[model samples]
Target: MNLEDLRAVRSRERSSDSLQDLRASFYEEVADYIQERKDARERAAAEADDPFSSEEVQTLTDEIETAEQVAEAIYERRMGKLVKQASLAAAGMTGDTDGLTNEERRLYEDLVARIEENKSHVLDVLAGEVEPGAEATGDDDAEPDPIDAAHANPEPGELSEPADDAVAPPDSARDESSAAAAMGGGLDGAEEPAAVDDAAVSTSRASDEEGDEAGAERTTVRITRDVGDVLGVDERQYSLEAEDVVVLPEENAKPLVEKDAAEEL
Candidate 1:
């Protein structure tokens, strides 16, 4: 072979070898990097407050590896196509032929752009980032709640039971009050006997129910009303997500929404 032909052959051979090495080395490097990440994740889990056991780690790692492999496959295919095109162009452009036809120039530019784009995607995937425009979707076929689906109830469900008041006296106070009212009105108070009797019955019933639930068994937490008043309106307006707060107080210091009549105009 002539000097130019020998040079061309050597160049093609080197390109082929380089491409082969890249193909193998890419996966090996990616595998090692992924393994290192897995090891780090396992160590983190072990040190976490709620540690993942070996079995849990194994399961999660399996899932993660499987997903990563799928992503790598897509990256590999895209990269392989681009590399093949680039290698073919390199092989064709053997001599120092800088001056080219319009079609050839366009093809070379397109090939270069494709190579760059695909190579970047492969590197991104290997580095544990997702490819552009790839989205994962799942089934959205679950049935809705009957009450919610119906929309019959405009309001949310019944309010949870209120927390007990700490400063307020127990059921005994109501009992004393009832006794005093009964004694004060017993045939010697204002209005007719029937009206007096009805009022006493109503009061007694209310006192009995209140006594049943409002005994010393109730536990209460207290906060100052003025402290609640000092809270910014913006803070009051924002609702907390379940994950945002460590613990929700049994009783809210302020009502969820202030009533127009409840607040002074």
Candidate 2:
């Protein structure tokens, strides 16, 4: 393409949200145009009586620089749009793909595959259908608990009887138990306080569990733009990008939602 055509392509790309149509040989044409200009510039310089003041050579050099810059801008803008399109397709909402070059189409397909695969694995982990890091090792076998194994398969000659020392209480222990029962008015009186203590402990445990659940509060969101790295309220770092679906602590997610950077999912 010519310098004017490159500028026009860059203008269209900047002005439009969607990708503009381009020929299959667009990149090859640009390369050819730049090479032709370079050759012309060299010939002009060589033929000029005063090479330092060659107007044709200077004009060709400027055109080459501008064309390169415009082409790069057009490519970058199109690439960003393609990435977003691929993300949408991965989420099952296919969008327009009317003007993609063969190379771009391949890139789009690869992006979709990678995004879909990663999303599926994350969802599987959240759904409890897969364990984190389980895929890496391909090992699902769990080690047997030593206590459970011993109980499930005891040795044939293992003794089931109690030792001689466990047969009866010593006289001093019996006397102390009898004294405590008498002082408490009965065994029931002494055991009532222990029963209340057990109930108090149970109640405390329940309260602690409730507090833990509250502390772990999270919000699910869909990112609309690249947020890079964010330090979460849970003291962990999160790397977020456009079209990413993730769960963040409610406090950390609040700012992004309010800023319209992410929407609650």
Candidate 3:
């Protein structure tokens, strides 16, 4: 619980990949020890005629800071081991839990439970036992509409069939009807070419407008460092490297530019 004790624990944690056994009240003791040093430092400052000249207060202050750093280092190292242990346990490869304090044990259990739950759901989806984002219809036996059924499962050759109620025209009448139809078709076809041209122009203009809108939302930047793969705010994946020039959504580009990892172009 003293400064030397804190340093020794930190050294042991750094030397060993596995967590070292410690008392269940180890962190509580460390906190109490730091608080005691702070109180002592304050008392020494008040008692000394010249607080700035007091060596005892200075020593206590230094010890408090060092103890805090050492405690934090030990905690980070143990936490890393606990996270790895939790992952292994979730995968059915349980590790030693004897070294965990009550709080850490609870955290470990929670992590394992979450990992297992996620894995189970993902595996069920992969196995096709569950559908992704699918909702239950609650009526499995409900019949499909006739119109929808016909469209989904059309009969072969049905589209090519003619209506049954039809009459044949006389030969002379048919010849006159064909002549009149040909003359009307010639007149309509002349306007059809112009209509087709207008449609092409309209489609091209729409595509250009879409391109301009997309350009406005994104920014051009040059990568100064290798950012292997990043997920953008726009939900697009970008693979970038040093010296690569690319366009990214403004939100995603801003962070990189501020970090000096990229320059806005």
lDDT of candidate 1 at residue 192, scale 0 to 100: 18
Score residue 29 of candidate 3 by CA lDDT: 91
Error of 3 at 209 (Å): 45
| Tens digits of per-residue lDDT for model 2, 1-265 | 6877887886687568898998867887888999998998899999999878888888888888767756655676687788889999999997667888777888988988888888877888889888877552223487677876775677898744444546678875665454323222100100011112444445545644564687776666666544545456555656554455666666666766765666775
Candidate 1: misplaced stretches above 4 Å? Answer: 1-33, 44-56, 91-265
Residues forming the 10-long window of minimal summed lDDT in candidate 1: 256-265
Query: What are the per-residue Cα lDDT tens digits for candidate 3 across 76-176?
Result: 66777888899999999967787777778889889898888778778777889888975333345988879878867779866623546567888756654
CA error at residue 204 for candidate 2, angstroms: 54
Q: List the residue pairs that clash in candidate 2.
A: none
Q: After superposing candidate 2 on the true structure, give the runs of residues whose Cα lies further than 4 Å from its correct spot.
A: 133-265
Give the distance in Å from residue 108's predicted Cα in candidate 2 to where it truly belongs. Answer: 1.1
lDDT scores in order: 0.37, 0.67, 0.67
Least accurate stretch of 10 residues (summed lDDT) in model 3? 185-194
